[model samples]
Every structure is written in structure tokens, then in C-alpha cells.
Target: MEKTLKRLSSIRTESDILREFLAEFLGTLTFVCIGCSANAVMLQMPELSLINGPLSWGLALSVSIYVSGGVSGGHLNPAVSLGLASIGKLQWKKLLHYFLGQYLGAFVGSLLAYAIYNQTIDRMPNDITWPIFGTKSASHINAGSAFLDQIISTMFFLMIICSLTDEDNPMKPSKGLLPFAIGFINFGSMIASFSYNCGGALNPARDLMPRIMTAIFGWKSAPFAYNDYNYFWIPIVACHLGGILGCWIYRLMIGNHWK
Candidate 1:
């Protein structure tokens, strides 16, 4: 009887963990659904998206975090989770769970967005250089500039994220407001970087899964190439490095000072 009770308790604990993972999956899905779909609308109808793109994405992200923050810390982006883990604020063991949830969520979320906007996509001009579901560099920015943009912007992103969540910081935001602060920072980053063809893809799952969706939809290898250069690797590699760098910088500046 005692052993059976212990087994039942363990099962309940496992069930709770699964629920947390489900929360992350649903949160990320909602996050990318809004972000990617907004970009899709911009691609098809720039007029409608011009004013709403950055703001809507930021607000959607805030909502995602608010919905799942208590259960999973609402790490809808892999880079954010990795950054926190690199700083010892998040357990490395939990990374696999978070990543799996985020990637799958982003994948399905983007697909859902595509389903909503396929009509507009079909009507795009052949000259329509805007991305459908994947990121592409703008003409003014070459591969090098685009890569630099992602790396540096991601550094700023993770730095702010870490600072906001830093326990040692005297001005940490209350739980209710942290998501808004993050959303504002994300909006600021987009306003600053999106014009440069950086695509403002701070998360690999956000970039790659949608790209995969495009590929599945028959865009083929084009989503991975821009300016006759294969740039698929830039955002993924740079953001991870940026996260590590941000964690290092934060540790040097504040985390290391903690007793």
C-alpha cells in the first residue's frame, strides 16, 4: 500500500511537469502565430503591416508570457532560455524540455498563420521580394551587415532580459510587469533592427521553423537563401553566441558580484 501511494505521487508529479511543458508549447505557439502572421501580412500588404507589425508582435509576446509565465517562465524563445541557463538562472537539464516545446510550438504556430494568410500570399506580385514565412535580408544590408545586426541586437536583447530577471538587481520588476518590460524591449529592438534586414529574428525556433514551413509549402530552398548567398546559418549561430555573450557580460557586470 505504501509503495502504491508513492508511485501515485510520482505520477502526479510527472503529470505536473507535463502540464508545464504543455504550457510552454501553447505559449510559444501563440507567440509565433501572431509574430509570423503579422510579417506575412506585411509581405502581402505592406500598408496594413507597416504600422502594426512591430507593435503587434511585441504585444503578442507579452500575452504569451503572461499566459504561461507562472508555469514555465514563458520562455517562448530558445535563445532566452539558453541565455538564462548559461547564467545559471535556469537549469541546463530543463533546456531539452523548453526547446522541444518551443520548437514544436513555433512550427505549428507558423503553419496556423500560413493557413490564415495563404490567400494573400498567393496574390503577391512576382516582384514581391518580401518574405512569405521565412526571413530574408534586405538589399541595403549584405551578409556581413545582416549577421552583425543579429548578433549585436541579440546581445542587447538577452542583456536586457537578464537584467530584468536578475534577482540581485534592486529594481527588478514585479511578476505582473515583467512581460510588458520584455515586450517593450522587443518592440524597441524591432524598430531599431528590422529596417536593416536583420529580420529581428532573435530566436532560432522563430526563424527556422517558419522557414521549414515555407519549404514544406513548396518554396523549397529559396527561404534559406538571399542575395544569392545562403544565409540560413547566420541567425541561428549568431543568436546562440549572442546569448552566451550576454550571459558572460551580465555575469561580469552583476551576477558575479552575487555572494
Candidate 2:
């Protein structure tokens, strides 16, 4: 009876869940708002993206992680949340809270970006502006190739993320630098694949939510109907699988080897 009562007492309450939800929400919002703002800027000046896109997204992720890492571990992306949960690092029950927070936060963040750039957005062509809110495959790639691209890229991303945050890893960064280190991983990823099959959307919430916003806010169904809707689901579905596989691979290769 004493053990049962102690366990019950230690269980997270509704308030704890709420706090985590709010942290994830705010963190994701910060990430999307800042990252998409950079995308918006690059729409007007395409040449700038070669430098601006990677740097802005990396710093944006770093800042967002710093903002909410204390409260919720700053799994600002659903892929990160799913990966951690799969590895038993996060409670399965908390997946709903994290998903809701991340998706809602991403949607609201897109709205904020829209509010800030509506005038310029209205003047830009749809093709130019839509990518600001969502990813589109480069014409050379088909849906199958794009799907594989997301899987491979996101798999690599989550593998590194698990390494960076693993407490048992000998070379893990200090807590203070973890955010920046993870941010640079993202930066390096973008530099390598930002123009790849689907712009390397490693986070489902980051891609899908903002893509939905583009559909609603004047881009219409073209955002979803692109490539006969075949391309639309690649980022969402592939990232989840990639995240899970990445965590599994990390545990198999490095995490399980830790003493």
C-alpha cells in the first residue's frame, strides 16, 4: 500500500502536463516563426538563401531550444518527440500532449508569419511565396525519391540528436551548449540538402502545419494537390518512420555500447 501510494504521488498531474504542453507550444512557435521568416525573406531574394536559410534555421532552433528545454526538453519537432518516446526516454502517454502542442504551435506560428508578411506575400507569385510556408520537391525528383530523401535525411538528423542529448554518451555536449550543437547539426543538414528532393523537412509538424496554412491563406489547395497529392504525405509519414529508425540505430550502434 505504501509503494502504491508513493507511486501515485509521483505521477505527473494535470498541471504538469499543461506546463509541458505550453513549453512545447511556445518552443515550436518560436522555431517556426523565425525559420519561416527567413524563408519569407529569401522568397524575395532567392540568392540570399544559399547563406541565410541554413544560418537562420540553425539559430532559430537554438533559440527555441534554449527557450523551452528546461520545461519540456524542447522537442519542438514531432519527429524528435516520437524518437524520444520510442526509445523510452519519454512517456508514451505524453505523446498526445506533445503532438498537440507542436502541431498547434506550428499552425499558429505560420499565422504569425503570415501576419508579418502579408503585404509582401500578396505581391509575390504563388510559386515564390508558397515555399515560404511549405516544402516542394525539386522537379528532378519523383515522389518515391523524395520519400527516400526524407527518410534518409531525417534518419541522420535524429541519430545525431539522440547522440547529442544522451546523458551516458562520453562526448555529449554540456547542457548549456546542447542547443547550439543541435542547431548546427540542422544548419549543416540544410546546407547539404536544402535543395534536395523535398528541402529536407525532418519535422512533420513543421512541414504539414505550415503547409496547411498555405492552403488556407490564399495558396488554396495547390499546396496539398501538388504532385497529385503524392508529395504531400511524404514529409509527414517518412519523418516519423525515419525518427523511429534513427533512434533504433543509435541505440544499436552507440547508445547500447555506453558503459
Candidate 3:
């Protein structure tokens, strides 16, 4: 405990903390903006959605990480930040700072996307535009199943991330290529599962903050009222659970075995 405190103290200089905050903020903002813009584009081009949605999101994340990784380890997602903290890879003292940046960034990103696409959005129906900002469970699934699906999706994502960055893992990608590799994971995950369930919101910030924007803009009750409000909270709660679970499983099965 004493050693942990000392380590945290040594790194908690004001400048360092501020840099981390800004890095997370900018990284998340870039990611959400690009991803949402893609959604907006897909809104105009429905036939190409199968090829566009996952690919755009994947590239957005890759670029964001490349931009922020040097300064802050590029944890653009609150789920990733919390998961790393749970495993002691991130100091708990910095978690709130990270969360503040991530959430605010997401909100701003959503606002930016809306600003750019409002003209188009205005012409479309609210039901069509809302999914670009937030997520909705598919008609076949209830809130419970959606919740479980998110947990599993995020769990798998976090597990792969943990493995990719594990210092002791023999198969980890080179540092320069890690972001793209992670991006591909996201792309593949989205292709396989993002559409089938709750639109693949592996990150809460990606969903909740934008959802708030939609509510305030013109979406009103629909974003929250969809699925009787039961589905609105699933990604936020389940992803955190999934992150911790993923890290724990990795630690038990692989991390602990590293010599």
C-alpha cells in the first residue's frame, strides 16, 4: 500500500494529470466524432451499411489511439480506463479524472456530429437518426438479453486488449501496430455482433453521452423511453462489469502464469 501510494504520488504532478485528462478527452472526442459521422453517412447510404459501419468505427478508434497513446496511453473508453485501473495497470486515483474527460469528450463529440449533420438529420425521421447517436436493442431481444450480450462483447474486447498489450505475452503486436490490431478486433467484433444486439456499444461513453445529446436536441423521450428505459442503462453497467471480468479472467489464466 505504501509503495503504491508513493508511485501514484510521484506521477501525480499537475501537468501530468492535466495531460492525461486532455489526452483522454481529445482521443474520445476524435473517436466519437468520426464514428458518428460514419453513422450519419450510412444514414444517407443504407445499402452500404454492411461494409461501412464497422470499418469506419474501427478506423476511428485506431486514429484516436494513435493521436493520444503517446501522452496518456490512449484509453478513450471509460470501460478501458476502469478495467486497467482494476488490474492496477492504472492508478485508482486517476480514474475520476479519466472518466470526466471521457464523458465530456463524448458529449462534445456528439454535439459536433449533430452540428455537422443537423441539416440532414432534420430531413430524416427521429427513429432513423437516433441510432446514429445512441443504440437500441434489436426487436428480438429484451433488455436482459441485450445486457448479457453487451457484457460478453465488451468482455471479449477487453480480454483481447489485455492480451495484446501484455508485456509478457509472446504474441503481442509491435508497439507501432498495436492500435491497428486493436482496431481490427473492434471491426471484427462489430461485424459479428454489433448489429445483432445493442449496436455494439462496447464503450459507455460512446453510447450514454451521445444519447444525452439526442435527448436534448430533438429526440426527447424516445432515446430513454425505447425499451421502457430498461435498455438505456445496459451498456454503462454491463461494460464495466465486462471489463473487470475480462481483466480478471486474463489475470487468472494468463497474466498470473507469466514468469
In order of lDDT, best first, we have: 3, 2, 1
Per model, how many backbone clashes are there?
Answer: 0, 0, 0
The residue-by-residue lDDT of candidate 1 on 122-187, one tens digit each, is 675422533655566677777788788777878888888888898788888998999998998888
Residue 236 in candidate 2 has what lDDT?
A: 94
Q: Against the correct fold, how does model 3 do in TM-score?
A: 0.93
User: Who is ahead in lDDT, 1 or 3?
Assistant: 3
Q: For residues 112-226, what per-residue lDDT tens digits would candidate 3 score against the true structure?
A: 9999999999998887789998878998898889989988888888899999999999999998999999889899865346557778899999999999999999999888888
The segments of candidate 2 whose C-alpha lies over 4 angstroms from its true place after superposition are 1-14
| Candidate 1 TM-score to native | 0.87
How do the predictions measure up, each by TM-score? 0.87, 0.92, 0.93
- Across residues 151-180, which tens digit of lDDT does each residue of candidate 2 receive? 888888999999988889889999999999
Q: Which scores better on lDDT, 2 or 3?
A: 3
